[model samples]
Structure formats: C-alpha cells, structure tokens
Target: MRFLSLAGWLTVVVATAAPPSVELQLQDEAKQLVVRVEGQPAMAYQFGDEFALPHFWPLRSPSEKLLTVQRPDPYPHHRSLWIADKVQMGDGPVVDFYHSWKNLRRPSKPADGFRHFIRHQRFSEMKTEGATALIEIELQWIVDDNRPLLDEHRKLRLVALGNGAYFFDLTWNLQPHEGDVKFLSDGVHYAWPYVRMHPQFSGEQGGVLTNDEGRRGQAGTNDQTARWIDYSNTVAGETEGLALFVYPDDTPPQWLTREYGTFGPRRAEKWSGTKFTLRAGESLHGRVGVFVHRGDAKSGRVAEHYRQYVEDKL
Candidate 1:
C-alpha cells in the first residue's frame, strides 16, 4: 500500500510539472488546418478552393469561446481574420482580391468562376518545437484561372501561453511573379489583415476597443495610428480578448477600427489611396502578432506582451 501511494503521488507531480503544448492537424477533407493548444481546438485556417480566398475563421478565446465571426452582414467580404488588397498585374485589369467575389463570374460558384484569388498552393512546413507549432505555406496570387501574378510565402507560429492563452505570429512575403504588381488599395476599405469579432463580443455588445496609446472605441481609435490594438469583453460571465500588434518598424500610419466588431492596421500612408509597385524580383513583406488572452487588455498585460513582441521575447 505504501509503494502504491508513492507511485500515485509521483504521477500527480509529473502531470503538474508538464509544460503546455501546441499541435497542428491537417484536415484534408475539410480543407482546413486546425490548431490545438493543450489538445483543445483554438483556431483553423480555411483554404478550400471553393472559398473566395484563404482566411482564418472561428478564432476562439482561451476558454474555447468563439471570438470571431465569418461573413457577417453589411460587409460579407469581411472574413473573420484575413489578408487582402487590390492589385493590378502589369497592364492587366485591376483585381480586387479584397472584395474577391466581385472578380468572380458566378459568385455563388466560387470553384467555377474565380477570376482572381489568393490561392494556397501547399504547406511547405508543419512542425512543433518545444511548446510552439510552426507552419509555412506557399500561395499564389492568381488571375484568369492559371496566370500567377504573385508568389507568396506565409509563415505562422503559434506558442502556447499558459493558463489557456496563446500567442500567434504571422508573416507574409509577396513577390511579383510576372512583371510589376501594383497595389491600388483605398485608404478606407482595407486592413493588412482584419479581425471581425463575434456579435457577443462586439463593442455594441459591451466589448472594449483599446489602443497602445490609451485610446478607446471606434471614435477614438479609428483612422489613428497605433503600435497595437485590443478588443475585449465579458461574455457568459467570462472575460477574454485578443490583441493585434504591429511590428515596430512596420507600424502602419493608421489603423481601422469599427464598433461593429471589425478592426486592424491599415497599410502605411504612402501606399493608401495611391499606387505602390513591387518589381518582378522585389518582395513586399509584413509581420503581425496576435495575443489571445483570458482577460481584458489591462489584466491581460497587453502592453507588456507588445513590448516582448517588439523585443523578440514573446
């Protein structure tokens, strides 16, 4: 009996000392890559060809509460979390990959009529190191079925933050595959990557929007520049939120925030409402961090995390 009790105690001790872990699972049939932290589903990357473009949906809070909404009304093009922009390849017609469906001949049948899209060609890497999972993928900005306009290399790293929270880092590198690719996005209608929160966590539903400089709400933060922004709220008696952080060197001159649940950093002033071009060998690169935590910005130490992000600590 004494020996059995000692063995039971050792088992409990080992379990308590175990570190958090992250896992990536490819669900081919679903055309999604599911990310799990400590064995719980946290988010998914949807890349089915049937989709107008690749996007991440069902981004959940630490407690597994859905924090994002896909295809919300008023602007169905606003995917939960995605990257998009308008571009013209060489002298070709301007392609609105942001409002991608507009480039489709038959909007309802995406697989049949997509004239321009950000296509996920393949996942080049998927591996776990310590408590973090890394994913690297190849994508193409294609036009007219098979004409590739840009080649993209996307990298994502997810780290398991203890107590149910997590940190995600994303990098995008785009190189013109053909001739010059001109970015012709408007200042008002775009984000480097947008996050649309679930209705329950929207500002209209009691969520709070905060920026690094201490601004709050759409009126205060919209069209304003910031190093980082956070949206948080208490839903079902639990407080949780997510923060988007821009790299110090790549901080956009302005950000777009909406009380209806949409928020993100816009491109720099030089590129907004104007044209920026990348030559055939030139690449446009950007990086951002997402911190999903179990409390509001204050309690979640959003500022601290942002600092770590800039210092390569987070």
Candidate 2:
C-alpha cells in the first residue's frame, strides 16, 4: 500500500477533526445536578435538602423530548428514575423508604410504624468528558431518629451514543451500616431502580411494550423475567423509546412492568415472605443497563445495543 503524501495526510487530519456530536456538560446547583448535552438540558439529579430521596427527573432524548415523569397527580410518590423499596432493619422494625418522603406527606398508619428516609450524603467522585459522565455518590437510609440503617454507594454513568441515542448504566453497592438489612417488597409490586415514563408514552397513547421473552403488552409482561424490556411510543410523527437491560448473571431479576409506564427489577415480595439480605459490613452489588433510543425497539436495534452493553463495547 502506498502511504499518503504529507499534503494529503494533513488534509485528511484536518477533515477528520470535527467536533463531537454530543458533549456531556454538568452544572452543579444547590438543589440539583443538571446535565446538558450540546448545551441543551438533558436531565437533572434532584438531591436537594427538600427531597426525601434522590431522583433523576425530566430525562430528555437527544431530540429534546422528555422521557421521564415526576410527581404525577395520580401517583404522587412515583418519581421519574429512582431506587427505592420497603426495607427491614435487622432486629429493628420495618420501614418504608419508598413512600415516606417528608415533602410527600403521605398519610401513614400508626400500625405501619416509623417511616424511614434515604438521604443523600455526598458525592465521592464525578467526571465528565466529550460523550460520557460518571458520578459516584453516597447515601444513607435512615430512620426518624437519624439512625442510619444502610449505606449505599451508587455509580451512574451516561454516554451519548450518537444517532440520537444514549446509554445509561447504574451500579449499586449496598451495605448495612448498623446491622443486617433486608429489602422487603410490598407484595403488590417490587420497586427498585424504577423509571416512570412520561404520560405521552403511556399505553393509552399508542405505546408498545416488548421484552426479550417475546412478550408484549403490560398484562403479559408484568412480573415476568426478561433480559430486557422496551417501551416505545410515537410522538410528533417520530418513534422513540427507552429500554431496560438486566445484565447476564446466575439469577436474572424478576421485573415489574406497568402499562401506566413504570418498570424495574424488584426484590422478592413480602407476601412470599422473601427478603434480600445484606449483612453488616458486606455489600450487595447490582448492575443494570438503560438505552434511550430515537426509534422503536426493533428500529433502534435495542437487542444489538444490549449485546454491545453486555460485551462492554459501549
């Protein structure tokens, strides 16, 4: 092969030096951490002193379409993207961190005992670059008396995957601060690492839900186990959607899906008297992959992206 001449090489280099299509820019505010892409608002991590638990709200696509919902009238406790569940504190009483937000003021039953809180402690590390942003944060699951029941180290990574798509990865390391802790389900649904889709993407709005097991619709896919689930909708004459992927492991997680647009993997249910135990000083780690694409599942090639994610290609 003949090598390029000096003049030709210089021309090639200059032509290839275009700016990146997307850039991950972060703005740290007093109450929220806002992330922008190409100078456009992408999403915000709401961990202010007023929030009961941290959440990512108003996640937007590269086309600037909102993908998540928060504090809808029907479900006041359903934040956009969050990790939460009813928990048991070893020998102590059971607590409901998922619904016990002080700002929520959800009526509580005395028999329900004291509600708990998940407070954002601090950010341990954060880094952002041309197309990716990674953040590590510490959180405390505490009771009314300020007794910390569990400590959580959560790592979130976001990457601009070109073609109006995005990749989001979440890793959680949880350990009991005082004693053993158990994630107890509410029996009706398991609520952990959840995403509430926007109202415009609801099934009533002509949205479609598909899973790896070839299941479709919210009824057949609910409480089912699948490697990935996609919820797609047509908005303004364009098809776009979000997908959830459960990494390959010995035991795949049982997922919770809804037509109203809430989905996530859940811990075992209380009706089954099941609990995921985390011993003191021992951390329980879990990981998941999320893809936000510009088209429906098939059109977006969600399976292919999921394969790349599993292989760590992206």
Candidate 3:
C-alpha cells in the first residue's frame, strides 16, 4: 500500500469536498445583509443613510480576503459598489447626488443644487435557497426637505458557483416620482455602478486588469467600451479578484476602470453635455453582473464566464 503525506491527503480532501454553501443573513436593524459561504462571511450589502446611496462594501473572495475598500480617503465617494449620478428633474437644475454626501454639513445650499439622499424605503424581498440568495429593495431619492425626485427598485441575486467563485446579478430600475428626470454629467465621469477594490489589489501593487476587448491596464482602458473587465490581484498568498460584466440587453455602459483599483461603468462621457430621460411613469432599467473568483483574468476563465453571462448559461 502506498502512504500519502498528511498535506497531500488534506489537499485531496479539500479538492474533493462538496462546494461551499452560501447563506445570506439580513440584519434589518443593522441595515446590512451578510452573505456567508461555507459558514465564512463573504460580503455585505449596506443600505444605511450614512451615504447618499445604497452600496455593497467589504466584499470578499472565497479565500475570505477582502476584495473591496470601504470608503477610501480622498475619494470617500468611491464606495465598494454603488450607483448614482448628477441628475435633474424635468428642466430643473442639476442635483449632485453622486457627491452630495459631502455637502451634508452645509445645510444652506440653494434648492437647485441642494444635496440629495437615497433613503432605503424597505426591503421588498429577501430570500435564500440552496446555493443562491436574492435581495430586493425600494429606495426614494430625495432632496430639499423630503422632496422626492425618483423611485428606484434594486434587486440582487448572489449564487455560489463553487471553485472559489461567486456570481451576482444586479438589476436597477428608476422612475421619476415627479416628472421626467435626466441623468447628466459634465466631465468624463457620470452616474453609474462602480467598485473600489482594496488597496492590496491596486494595479500599482502588482495587480492586473484586462477587458474583453483585449486592453490591459487603466492607461488605455478607462472610458473604453467592453462587455466586461477583470481586475485581479494576489492576497494572503493566493490570487483572486473581481470582474464586472455589462449585460448586452442593457445600455452599453462605458468602462470607468482605474489602475488604483476601481472599476465601474460611466455614462458621463456618453452623455457629456447631453442627457437621457427616465420618462414620467416609465422606468429605466439597468442590469449588470459581478463575479468574484480566485485567479487572474485568464486563469479565472473570464471569457468563459462572459460567454455564459451573455448566453444566459449562468
């Protein structure tokens, strides 16, 4: 009989073990939704009023390593994962919802430029079954003493994909509570979904970024178009990262990736000096995918994942 080393036996056991199970725990009073994989805390959804919008922070990979930085300095607006933008109601002046949280202290701003807040109205749905968890919420975008501008419905589904990976599908719908609203941006950045990776995963720290279009790094990737982009780095002696995917069914959102470890989609340049409307009584929809895995782009099978996403195989 052949005798295997202890380490070898352990490795085999780990490899052959059943995939990790995922559990989502909702802490309503704490205003957080926690996701656990194989009994290890994996991520959290934050919907508290501490920020201007709802976001996910402290995202982690299968290695239990944090993959996102929560409210980094100099850019506290850069949440782990969020959506917001400068917007206007009908012909009204632009309201800086994206960065308005900074102006919370200055209570005397003009009504036209008043800071806005996204208040979590309620959790419409929260359920966990098998290897997936689903969350849905309703939010009110308000300004100037509870003046509502928009109503948003956000839904997220997290699935355990095994192999040190998890997948999340997100859908957001916005409707003008008053009248038509426009999402506008003056610069190269706009209101959209984004992620801020942990400093350990910054491109300056030996991390790698790749897009479906074959572009590498933030130098030539920012504001570029791609179906998806992957940002990978090593942590705790293991390689892992996150990838953002833009579903073909939704509007083609441009990449707002960075080398310092931020990834997002922007409509600013796409709507520079112009704006699109979320008509009254009509909802504008946005869909996206987030993949957390344990490897670099190729090693993580990024393309295969994208194909699965577009083909609805996931």
The TM-score leader among the candidates is 1
lDDT of 2 by residue, 1-314 (tens): 23345755542223333333444344456667776655667777888655667888878866888888888656777889988767777567677766654323344533333346688888898788788888888998877557888889999888877655678788888888877788776756654578899988867678888988778888878877778899889988888998988778645567778888888875423222265676778876767888888888898899999899889887
- Compared with the true structure, the alpha-carbon lDDT of candidate 2 equals 0.76
Model 3: lDDT equals: 0.79
TM per candidate comes to 0.93, 0.85, 0.87
Q: Candidate 2 clashing pairs?
A: none
Please list the C-alpha lDDT of all candidates, in the order they appear: 0.88, 0.76, 0.79
Error of 1 at 282 (Å): 0.9
**Residue 313, candidate 3: C-alpha displacement in angstroms:** 1.7
Q: Name the candidate that leads on lDDT.
A: 1
lDDT of 2 at 261: 86
Q: How many residue pairs clash (N, CA or C atoms closer than 3 angstroms) in each of the candidate models, in the order given?
A: 0, 0, 0
Off by over 4 Å in 3: 1-16, 91-93, 107-115, 250-252, 267-273
Residue ranges of candidate 1 with Cα displaced over 4 Å: 1-17, 107-111, 250-252
Write model 1 residue lDDT over 1-314, tens digit each, in one string.
12234645552223344688898889999999999988899999999987778989889999999999888986888889998888898789899888877888776866676777889999999999878999999999888888998999999999998877999999999999979999988778788888899988899999999999899999999999999999999999999999999997754558889999999987666666577898889988878899999889999999999999999987
Give a tens-digit lDDT track for model 3, residues 1-314.
Answer: 23346755542223356755788888878888898867778889887766667788878887888789877865877788887777788666568777765446464643333356787899899888878889898988887648889999999988888865889899898889978888776456653576888888879788888988789999878877778889898877899989988888645667777788877775423353366777788876777889999889998898899889889877
lDDT of 1 at 312: 94
